[model samples]
Target: MTTSRPFADIDTWVFDLDNTLYPHHVNLWQQVDVRIGEFVGAFLKISAEEARVIQKDYYRRYGTTMRGMMTEHGVLADDYLAYVHQIDHSPLQPNPAMGAAIARLPGRKLILTNGSTDHADKVLQRLGISAHFEAVFDIIAAELEPKPAPRTYQKFLDLHQVDPTKAAMFEDLARNLVVPHQLGMTTVLVVPDGSKEVVREDWELEGRGAAHVDHVTDDLTGFLQGLSKAS
Candidate 1:
């Protein structure tokens, strides 16, 4: 909940690659979940269903299922990423409207994602908008530090030479955006249509402090349009 308008002057736009760029209802995560279950089953010598339960537990405890698997089960990161991303991407179609919106945005645009660079490349290629971003900061760039961690955000800004004051973070996850807000960067929550259930507004508000939310919009294009008008 922001009291005042914070979109007065923004020079750089940092975007999250996954659900933020595209709608989650597209069911890409379902594929990833299936892969995770399969990997867990094979690694732990358990049923897929049991593996699913263990995967959830790991995610809850270690922030990521892979992290838990690495620490507890001694799984390799490369193997995990390879198995998880082995899915059909034909369902993803090009979002020309999104591409147009990215083209209209003012200043540098970069992607900051917890996913792998190869996956990011595949998604961008599928969306037909790889040219929209100047650079992409994926999981490799973060050095395995996932979102909601202050250090990850700090490292991202440091690596990209981004000024917190001039940059805005556009993410679908409220927790991830919370850190950038704390660092004096404007935060925009991209809530796609029909995906309101996934956006945890209450959790975001609960943690709101110096790093407060600035805007919440259902459509990224409309939000950027409003910013253009405000500017």
Candidate 2:
């Protein structure tokens, strides 16, 4: 919000799915995380506990656990994607305020996510905001590459014909904002509201004065509403 004429020049609004779109307290991702480990365990013929360690390690090393599996074990991406996304989406609900605020914003709005379009569609449809977005640029669209990767961001820009300077990206991961900020897009980090207990890594929540983040917000609905008010 401190940036000069915030949203004044932004013609493209980009948002990350998962925690960035829905509240972290919903804990929907927890089910996916568990399923991911289970898939890994089944694939490797290992215990669930051991597979989780590898899953976390791969996530840290490859920007995504699926990528690591592909690189190290020659696993098919579709196999992993299909398995990890089978969790129930019942935890999500429509946020009329958030949808209304987003609908009020001018220009094209898109979801840039590390997830598959199938997963993004489910989340958006569940939230009842599917009509508000122009499109979703997902991991498959990025050729299986995930965020925090510069080339993936470039591919997304090229695909959408988005000018970084005129775009704003909102994400839950601070690291994911690094590439967007470096590309000259205004980067916003969305954090948990603390109404529910959610565990996050120190780096994931650490943003404030970080050079990569231009803004931070806990209440996305309120934050977008405020932006609309000023505009």
Candidate 3:
């Protein structure tokens, strides 16, 4: 494989937990999606179909459904987080290849996720890569502020004492990379393999501000493996 110099000089490696670490084909988010709709339906006393529309609306309007629920319906953030993350983690099997690649990186590794720590822990444990990370900074750690929010990024950097210039953030969402890029961290967008069509949803599409993205990779394992080989 051809090697690249994308990750050079990075001392702190930050990763987003969902589709970034695992392949999108696993479809773990589909379960979470159903649960979110259920939670909303139950909470709002509305039908599931109606709740689904509201769920997507909240996700678009507030950056997260939990934020919108809390703001509009006085729902507890933890309640929503716990309820939605209760799915089985069997889809994510042990990935020693990814573990080995990450282990070779010369830096502190951390997972910064919009999901709760419980969910992050389960995913990491299932992947057999839990020991490699120094910490998992979840939504609660960000005071329920989700990513793409500049303050959350600053909080992650401050709490972890990571130098943005020496840090690199890997995320599946293009919009989330913008603040990291502006903060001097190398930003990598992890898109799904064989994504040829224009992404239809506003939230699903890559940001036009993708100039902030320093690099884009579809295969995170291979990308990280290349970094390992270069080192």
Candidate 4:
């Protein structure tokens, strides 16, 4: 059970936009997943099956498939971001309860995403929580670098003037929270609720008991609502 006391001192609430903010049953991110595969296939001029293999391989090696493409194939970040993020926001809807919970959190809210600002904005707006976040630190802001990278986390901190010890980070991927945990921020891993049939890899499901992860929750709204007011 999550209690309020542990988070009392945390003032800055940083959240990852995709799987963190909403539940997986919505299949909102699944759209992006399909788009990434399509983009990889078309861009690499390879078969869809081959693209899937390369996508997962690249994602495993690099924090993002885009980074892998950039490093190996000289793909432009702008084009890749534009192509992958052209997903439908129809699957997602306004979650007033989530917005209310987020609004209740003490201090400021920010989004730290490996995606573009446009994609983050679209997701936030579709979920009706765009107003709650003060700013979004996106891939462009981090110079195309993604999370799990120490330098990217440091750059976000420097750019936002955030105190890691006084902040909390909510992310879907446990590996993405490692850098934040190392930097003294409270790391919460948002896992899928398992209410839906979403395909996932074995590695994607790892890190549940990792030392760096401070908390794990399938219900983001409940977790946010349960937090005690920041001291």
Q: Pick the candidate with the highest TM-score.
A: 2
What is the TM-score of each predicted model, taking all chains together? 0.87, 0.96, 0.93, 0.95
Indicate the TM-score of model 3: 0.93
Off by over 4 Å in 3: 1-5, 195-202
Clashing pairs in 4: 4-228, 8-231
Candidate 2 accuracy as lDDT: 0.90
Local distance difference test, each candidate: 0.79, 0.90, 0.87, 0.88
72, model 4: CA deviation in Å?
Answer: 0.2
> Which candidate would rank higher by lDDT, 1 or 2?
2
TM-score preference between candidates 1 and 3, better one: 3
Error of 2 at 42 (Å): 1.2
Query: Which residues of candidate 1, in runs, are more than 4 Å off?
Result: 1-5, 195-211
Error of 4 at 162 (Å): 0.3
Cα lDDT tens digits for candidate 4, 1-231: 343326868899999988789786787777878889999999989999999999999888899999999999999999998899888898888999999999998898999999999999889989999999999999999999887789999999999999999999999888998889889999898989988876666787789888888898999998888883432
Better of 3 and 4 by lDDT: 4
